[model samples]
Target: MRHDSATLIILLAVVALIAWFAPDVVLIVFAGCLLAVALRAPGVPLARRLGIAEHWGVMIVALVALVALGLLVWFGFATLADQAREFSRAVPRVLERAGTLLEGLPGGDWLKGQAQPEAVQPSARAAANFALAGVSGTLGALGNALLVLLLGLYIGADPTLYRRGALALLSPGLRPRGEATLNAMAHSLRGWLLGQMFGMAFTGVFTFLGLWALGVPLAALLAILTAIFGFMPYIGPVIGAVPAVLIAASHDTSLVPWVIALFFASQNIEGNFLTPMVQKQSSDVPPALLLGAQALFGTGLGFLGILLAAPIAAAGMAALRVSYVEGWVEDPADTDEKRIIRPA
Candidate 1:
């Protein structure tokens, strides 16, 4: 018993060490899993329709998506870059104005002081180093993007390979149940990816149109941010809307209310209409549970954790219900079958 206990403790320590040191790799793999689901979701239907292999169908769909994305970037990247640059320059002025406006409120003086930039000047060498670091970071991001793409392709091409390997970790008796749990988890993730994709697109399109109609600056950039962050539930939309509201407030205080109203309406539609319609087939998780998971994982794993928090929570909840709660924890104490089979 002591030997078994020691082995269990050592195994847990190893797992903890890996989690602490390799959060990024874990997140990257998670991204690959999500991409695989996204690819497989449409690929399976296309394969059936075209009488082609599922893998081939996935490749074709991926290629089409890549082409569409390339064309979009080609046409829109220049405008986005310009707007991003303008927004960066405008940020300081906007902050200053915000500080002034809040001067009458509590902590307003401290806030204004914090917003006021220090008079310290950096050397040209320091500026050069900053620029070099920015370039390095951009290149690193590109590298990570390529890695994620390759991982996704490999995983999506033969998902069963990985699934089989995962199931192998279980004892023979538990393997069947493990496989079932994995299938359920896959369904949950696939449903999530579908709902999330629709939500992001819906949020982006409506936000762009509404902001443009309101003549808001940086509307396109803001819309893109909104769409990307829309994947995160509850807190994401609020974070996405803040910049647009700030920009509006800087331009004209009156426009602030209009910008807020637009976001409010969009969120209402998303919460009431789009989410329900899309998530109907998806796994259901409580909002508070999801929020708690987000907070915990986000603190430990940063942005990637926050991005995938809901799916993780849903999957975990499903597994616990299936394998733990239903299987043993809540098993009936006295059953008719058991009583009848007892010794006379």
Candidate 2:
């Protein structure tokens, strides 16, 4: 109906407005939705096992999950702290060597005279500030973290409420189809998240092992960083590897090729083998479409926009397929039983 189409457009407009006007809050909501779904998978059986009320089970499960996450964060921070200390000790020597090497180049004398001293000072100060900012930005992230945790807790307690609430907004007769559509959406999202998580973990492990074999320092920190990047759709592997390669390059030029090969190889394995095997829930969307969505979302919103764009678009697609194409204009020749996903 025209009314439903208008409503869909309005809903999308509202979502886009929120994303544009309040990206940080939108990010928290996105993270909350994902974390809630993650907890939902393990919450059901445990709830029944403990004979607790569903809400109480949510609290317990959420508590356990949050605690586990806190520990992981602590461990990762500890590793990063160690790496930072090592960097503080080693960076000066690395820079000095780099300067020496630069000074020894064939055109070094000419380049040195051409290099402006004031420009170098600002660049050095900017680099120092950037490093400090990396460790000092926790206060800003805390609010986002709390928002995600609270939202996850509330949603995990009553995910059905959200599904039903959303379905209720559809036309009365379309509610059943909406439910099925949402299930498909949930399946796709959960499967994608699971696949990415597994792939990221495997990539991180691969990074750590390879770096260790090549005598790279801060391998643990680098591995964790790689895992974070690998979760991102397109640009993650390259972003994660840049610093790793830079650090290795600083130590020894010969290590550059080895590090590059290892990083690319691990990601290739994940992309070719692990991802398809695990992420079988959602059929692959066209890469061009995916890239376009990412570009549009990134341009319209920000980093998290790029992150959630694909799934949000997929959910929209699923809903439209069910409501308009499949559910609305039923084929007259089809019997009720034969209708299924085709047309009724």
Candidate 3:
């Protein structure tokens, strides 16, 4: 028992060391795993229906997705770029207006003092760069993207090979439990991804129509931002609404409320209707828990972590349920027989 405890401690220390030193690589690999599951989720069923091999199905789906995304970027890139530039130009003026408004309010002086920008120290700059390394527009980001794509393709093609290899690391008696835990984790991730994808689509479409109807400037850009931020769950929608609100306020104060209402309604629809319906396959992981994980992972692992946090939290919940709750915490007599999830 002491030996086992020591071994576990050593293993944990090693993992921590690796995480601390190679967080970007770790996150990229993690991204690949989630992408594999997401791609395979629809691929397998489609493959069976069309009498095609699983790998071929996955390749087709992935290629189609890539082609669609490429086309979107190809067509929308100019408009997105223009909107981005316009937003950048508008931000300072908006901030100045906000600053003016704050100056007229109580505690205005204190707020202004607090908001003043200080020169970034060298260490702080380094830390900032490290945090942003995953999307730094450097070779690192490209390399990570390529790595994830290759890993996803290989893993999605024949996930069982990787699964068997992972299971082989455990003792013969523990292999079954390990396999079960991994399967549960994958299912949880797949469900979470599906739900999130649907949520993003719904948020984007709703936001676009509402903003366009309201004659908001850069409606498409804001809608895309809304969709991208949807991945971050609770806080994301709020952050996404900021630019729209600022731009609207710049135009007309009356438009500000309309923008706010638009976002509020969109979020309501997503949180109340879209998420619950899609997340039926995903077991409940508390909202508070997910938010906490997002905070922690974002702090530790940066943007990629924030993007993937919901699924990560879902997988964590599944692991805890399978390994700790069912395996040891609950009485076996009271527990229902759990079925192992198999690859399709």
Candidate 2 on 1-344: residue-level lDDT in tens? 67767766777698789867887777677779777767776676678889986767778788887799899878777778979799667655555445545687898766554443432444778888987886677766776778888898888788888877887777665566667667766666667777788899899999999999999888888898889877666667888998787678678879989999998899889977897688774535555776788788788777777777766665556655555566667652352533333210
Q: Candidate 3: deviation at residue 117, Å? A: 12
Cα RMSD (Å) per model? 5.9, 5.1, 4.1
Estimate TM-scores for all models.
0.87, 0.78, 0.87
Candidate 1 residue spans exceeding 4 A from truth: 1-17, 117-129, 330-344
lDDT of 1 at 120: 25
Candidate 2 vs. true structure, TM-score? 0.78
lDDT of 3 by residue, 1-344 (tens): 45544654565687789889998877888899988998899888889999999999999999999999999999999999999998877765666555555786899877755543332224867978876884666777788788999999999999999999877655565566667789889988888888888999999999999999998888999999989998888979999999888788766667888999999999998888878889885657788998998899889878888887887788888988876787669863576655556543
Rank by TM-score, descending?
A: 1, 3, 2
lDDT top scorer: 3
State the weakest 10-residue window (summed lDDT) of model 1.
Answer: 335-344
